[model samples]
Target: MSEQSLFERIGGREAVEAVVGSFYEAVAGEMSLRVLYPEDLTPSREKLEYFFEQWLGGEPRYSERYGHPRLRRRHFPFVIAEHHAQLWLKHMRSALELQQIEREDFDSIWGRLESLANHMVNAHEEVPREPLPEDAWLT
Candidate 1:
């Protein structure tokens, strides 16, 4: 028989769902990261569940529903700098650890996540420009 996919080995849909839920819970406490997420997390949770299912070698439901994930493009509207990526990874790591998964499986999954998160950085820190003084306006 063919070997089961990582998704299956990791306990399939239920596990992925649990991980997504826990991950969001962790993100809630990250003040800087919170601005990147929507006020209502339901949509975020659903998209993540579907994306992980497809990415982990299960059915391609995410693609079917949303077309190509185009993850980086989708994230472009947000300012995902290195600091944001690190915060994201931090929460994700905590969530994954809570699962008590096998070490090998954890390493494999974390590696992929790290690569993806690193690729998501699209901006860098810069000082905010001060508003022009009212008197500077042309009469």
Candidate 2:
């Protein structure tokens, strides 16, 4: 039998959507990462779902709609430091945990995401700021 794609092994499109939702929930709960995402988050969630689906060997909807996934270029506007990458990975790890994915699959997916998140870092300068209120990101 042919080897199943990661998407298939992970339960396909619906699973991808669910993971994305869980991921965003984790992100929203993280003050450090929440501000990086848009206020509404719906569009970001959809885009992340498509991106993850394609990345996991499913249909390439993200590339089909958005062309090449120049992720670094796309994220240049954000102050994506190493701290941001680590926080992003933390939320993603939590999201994957909620799915009860296998160890090998989880490792594989997390490795790729860690690499991608590290590559997305564009800003090196320290983020000068004061302690933010709990709802500061909502603004």
Candidate 3:
């Protein structure tokens, strides 16, 4: 390839793998996010690594293995609220920093990811979470 892909710019598979690893490490402890993941993170880790590898321009392996990545559709089963997206991005930023991805390069990647995360927000806008008198807890 003439131009170096973002994958290459961030130091290819090894670096991407490390970043993804760091991401899950953070997620593993984050209860809000943790509840959303399976008890076994291995599959999630593998799938994400493959997807990122291809998305960042190393190989077509993710698509090859998983077919079309219907990301939103895949995520449809989850009740992804706004807070969840923010938490996801927060960990993503930490992961990128942990891997020491260059600011400029990471910025580009971060922007796209932010949009993607926001797009995954399936919940409605914030509303008062009050309960009706009958529904309120009996104190």
Candidate 4:
């Protein structure tokens, strides 16, 4: 017989939803991450719920509803530098801890997500622009 999916091992749909919700809550606290999302995070939260559900091997709700994930392609618009990816993982790690999952299960999930976060980096950070010498500024 096949091994149980991470979804099942972690207690299925409700667990996934809880973890996703926690992840978003953590993400909300960070201004750097918060800037990437819309003011209203309801839609974003739902999308992540559906995505984590399928990604953890529960069901294909996300793909069925939104077509192929195209995760990297979809995230291309954002300038995801190394630090951004690390912050994303930090929030995700906190969310996973809130679930109190087993070590192996955590490893399985964490490994995949870490890879995904790193992969999402589409650009590097450039130096900040200098301010004009004059405070008066141009019209």
Window of ten residues with lowest summed lDDT in model 3:
130-139
Better of 2 and 3 by TM-score: 3
User: Residues 43-115, candidate 3, lDDT per residue (tens digit)?
Assistant: 8898889889998888966778777776765666567899999999999888888776788998899999999
lDDT for each residue of candidate 4 in 24-111, tens digit (9 for 90 to 100): 8988899998998778888888888888889988888888777778777667656778999999999888888888689998998999
Best-to-worst order by TM-score is: 1, 3, 2, 4
State the lDDT at 8 in candidate 2.
90
TM-score of every model?
A: 0.86, 0.85, 0.86, 0.84
User: Per-residue lDDT for 98-134 in model 2, tens only?
Assistant: 7867889988988888899998887874443333332
TM-score of candidate 3 against the unseen true structure: 0.86
Worst 10 residues of 4 by lDDT: 130-139
RMSD of every candidate to native, in Å, equals 9.6, 7.2, 10.1, 9.9
Point out the higher-scoring one by TM-score: 1 or 4. Answer: 1
In candidate 2 the C-alpha lDDT for residue 16 amounts to 89
Poorest 10 consecutive residues by lDDT, candidate 2:
130-139
Clashing pairs in 4: none
Regions more than 4 Å wrong, model 2: 125-139
